[model samples]
Target: MRGDTEWGSIPGLVRYASERYADAEAVVEGRTRITYAELGARVERSTAACMADGVRPGDRVAIWAPNTLDWIVAALGAVSAGAVLVPLNTRFKGAEASDVLRRSGARTLFVTGTFLGTSYVASLRRAMAAGGGLDALRVVVLADDAPADFRTWKDFLAEGEGVGQARVRRRWESVAGEWPSDLVYTSGTTGRPKGAVITHAQTLRAYEVWSDLAGLGTGDRYLIVNPFFHTFGYKAGVIACLTRGATMIPQPVFNVDTVLANLAAERVSVLPGPPTLLQSLLDHPARGAHDLSALRLVVTGAAVVPLRLVERLRDELRVATVLTAYGLSEASGIVTMCRRGDDPAVIAATSGRAIPGTEVRVDAPAPGEPGEVLVRGFNVMRGYWQDAAATAGTLTPDGWLRTGDVGVLDAAGNLRVTDRIKDMFIVGGFNAYPAEIEQLLGLHPDVADVAVVGVPDARLGEVGRAYVVRRAGAPLTGEDLMAWARREMANYKVPRSVEFVAELPRNASGKVVKGGLRGTPATG
Candidate 1:
């Protein structure tokens, strides 16, 4: 394959990979293994299916499924047919997913059947019914048996039967580098999720640099434990694998035993996830029995990495390369990454220097002080999908994106993330904005006021702890609040602990002083 400049569109990249590594294994999931040639063919057929369904250029297509080979094909196929892909978090409850789908105005949805005993299709139906129905959204289920109302995976693929291959080729060729590729929704400080619009060229170029820096190469087996809905798994995991000819092994969920078995069975060479994933593997009793000798590379970040975790990954796991990277959805999921051979202390202390063509600036009050991190680069998102006011608030008129993260830049340009200016805390690797959690907590009848803040944890790097003020005569407990939160939001967003107080500290402006609640005693 040619260098970065050659492939502009994702479909173009897939074509390039097929030609360069025709018979090479491209995807491995359970009993199925697909070659690059077959993968490319399937993507083309999927593109044709989308076209036949009247999916026009710039149309929004949503995928709400777990990590699987079908997810890759559907996403690539949709993008190839000039549709902007919108990935819904598998962890999202029906209402949450509906909000995103409704906001993005997605015209079509591709989902899975029962997984882990949760019927995603049923959840979606309930959400739509509750919201008075989605706007002409088409649903296609990728499983053996879908509801009578929806189309199955095979049926969806058959939509392309009558469409000519030449038509699909024309659609693929029509897509330009600057076209919108994916609309990934991230929760802002305002307590609502906004879609970050990223272009095809930006994504392809960014991950190419990522693949090179990480030393990913042909024939390397990559076990992707990261969820495909996020940029880390889709752009870095799938796109990076395609760009470098590495074989992708998609793990739907993160289980230590499954990961170990896949690593040894596939001779996995590259593995990337949050620190908790690696920690679990290290702590698992059966870890030593698994043939993890083939594990050669590891990439971890998204929370504070204890120096000991880094040391153990190398010393105990015997991995040759371990890298830490930092980026958000607005920046195409990468801003800086530690190089292959950097010192472990450096990897743990800072997220490495900005990638090529990207610049990082700290808006500090004085030298060496932490401030909001500003990023300007090719990887910067176009803007939020349609919310211009929200987009304007994030990106400056000139071009810099206000990351809402408070961090400092070293003399060498490495970024050290210290705190969040937006009060967004990462739980196990997922971002949980405090405003969103507080909004839900305030709805309880017995709660008079609530404030949420993040506290350090030994397992999950940080978990939310809420401080609440009970009504004068109401009998309310911290456990009651916790139970209510679990039903109202995603598991990661639920506060692990709650503290009931008689009153909450506030400033003259009436804003809750989050700092005062940080070290408060927990009632749970």
Candidate 2:
């Protein structure tokens, strides 16, 4: 768990993990339990499939699916074959998903057949039909039943029969630590989603620090509720488990009942997610029925973490370590974290001090004052994918990353995040950028203008509230707008409440003054 020097690349780590923890359990899904050796063999088969399907080193490969055994294998396999992995948000609607695939120039896609009763292939086809569609994509492998022309998962793996084991090993071995491992697309204040290019070394080193700090060990059973499309789920949940030989039980959704069931059934020992998840579990009336005694470690963040949350877990569930952290995709999804055995007040109030090999500072002149948060460290990403202008704008000449977050750093160097410079909100654990939501809402024919702001919610840390200006004679109601929005974007990105206005307030610079809109009272 040292760093890149210990395991040259992700593939190397996978190989070593497979051998070191070979007999130990790897992934448990329903009745199936895959050992480390078995998981390695599956990843190799998937890597061979990628090779057979013409995926070359540095080629972009996207996966539009949820957290499952297949997702773990497909993603790891693509990276092992030296392909740059691009994971699509499972919550994204067809058009949104297609937009990323088109922009990333992904040559291949591994998608689930149907999830939550939606046919992904059908969804993609409809979205693609409206536009030029994905003409560059040469392969579409479905985890379930195959469509007319698309290949099934079994068939896709079968196609790799011609590829020998030696060739697969060589391809993976050639993947250097410096090579870009994945392009995680994240939306910022600009409303346009950009891919953050992170290397295998950065991911490994950062998560190695994360795993060690959290005391993740070989015998731990982890319940990964975070979406795989997110950095927390893929890197922290999956990658960290690989490093420690922990068993992963991935839950596709955040249903409270399912989580309770898994905690008792799987004897889940490690749970890491946003504050909303832990809150719901704490409040569930049926909590006492389950034997949650096995849970030892709990890591939660991404919103205002209540001091009671840290105390409740320790008092109610008796979890040994409860830590809070803060991160962004630009910094490999980690910048600061509360160490184990830290003062519960410090862990609850701030995201703790910076990890080793990193520095965190605020733009304000004095300590304990709100200012732009900046990070310069080993965890910083190389740059945005193929966007030099954006990269230059974000990264300083001296290598400090301008994290568009307003925070106050204590004299002790603990970072207390105050606000987002981007006006971003977290719906459950998902990040909902207001600008992105506004852009999508602007597409509605009846909407002439829109502004979105994050309002405090009792359950979710915050939810989006949109103020809109309807077109002349449009007769658009908030209900109608919300209905249309539900069809257009991911559920999390859809604003919970909408208000129709004759015109939106604007500053002299002709920008929709969001600060004014943020104070607008609920009209429903």
Candidate 3:
């Protein structure tokens, strides 16, 4: 069955799990625990609802909500109905979400109401209104009290009442392994996000290998703290759990108290996220109050993994398997991962060898030196959706994806990611591109020029510090610039520190000397 191409579709995998796992618990959120069979039924009902709403194969459906049972159902259901899933970041402001929805041409949007005191639906509406409206977009609110203007989740599912199960099944059967299942937007140096299209086969196959390599299996309780929008949470977290029949506990946000409570209450054994997440768990004042003994496997990467953190996770936390993996959105969220029983030092220093069926190469200037990491495998994305030029730039004609990350492959085949070839930084696990922030900062009336660089931080691993050249006699202060940036961009993209400069250092070709900006003390 693993060798068959037809079984690699999202729906196909769900069906297989349902049939095999039967009454086994599949998803757990709050007090709700759904069996694999029950999940299958819900997915089918949701698929019918999507088809009733005229969703067709290749159509894009956007989901803009935090991690919840409904998020999983909506995503899988949309794919089952033959629509491509486009996950919008929960941190995205109105304009950012609007840009993705507009570019993806998502006909349907599944959004949540008030969360953390902010109404996502209202925010999106404001953005759409200002940005010429999303063409032919239908809003579906997933809330207990949905606004009167849009369809509620219950109402949306109720639309399937008149539709037959056979129709839904037909749509499910029509989808094949090669069909595009997801369009995940990744930020680039170009200052605009590009949607990396991935197929059902690619996702299922890659994560099957990921699940196996990570030692995921039935009855393992998985707590997913990563955002559902990113490939890390959706693919490696959710999809991996599904394929392995692990019970998934979806965490909406990364609150230490909530996570610790869930870890104790649910007996979560499988947890994966960036190093910051694990660090927070280890650093929390009340961490030992909760019974975290159930934690056995942990996967972390995306930023430098401190040797101390790896040692503590093993010695202090007593986790049996602490694996570090690496990849980008273009490669289905996993290219290389450490195996269980690997040396703690090796796991800390390098992202393990490439997963089965994937190849990693470093285009080094000198032997064993750090260079751009290139990947070639079934895991590679189909391409940047509708952007041939960007696709051509990133992917070689033969197949290797030119991952802009700089890394070196050791003699043992382990990949140690060094600096980025592109000016992108990770802020608490979120990718923040300097060019995008610089572009937004350049729009300030008092700003004459600006350059952004990643600076080391105690908490977030790396944060952006902007070096700004103000207009002559301008009264712009760093505080004022940051305040403006907070309003204009996502929280992670906003510069944590700002420094005023007489002039930005530039080279002969007139490029901002980002190297010179780093380590410079923040001004104001």
Best model number under TM-score: 2
lDDT of model 3 at position 478: 90
Taking the tens digit of each residue's C-alpha lDDT, what string does model 1 give over 1-524? 24346987998998898888889999998899999999999999999999989999999999999999999999999999999999999988888898899899999999988777789989988888887459488999998788888899899999888889899988888889999999999988779889999999999999999988898999899999999999999999999999988999999999989988998888998999999999999999998888888888998889888889899989998999999999999999999999988999999999899998999999999868899999999989999988999999999998999999999988888899999989989898888999888888899998899889999888888899999988889888888888888877889989999988879899999998999889887984
What ordering of candidates by lDDT runs from best to worst?
1, 2, 3
Ordered from best to worst TM-score, the candidate numbers read: 2, 3, 1
lDDT of each: 0.91, 0.91, 0.90
Tens digits of per-residue lDDT, candidate 3, 360-389, equal: 999989869989999999899999999999
Model 2, runs deviating above 4 Å = none
Residues 167-228 of candidate 2: C-alpha lDDT, one tens digit per residue: 99999899999999999999888988899999999989998999999999999999999999
Candidate 3: C-alpha lDDT: 0.90
- Model 1: lowest-lDDT 10 consecutive positions: 1-10
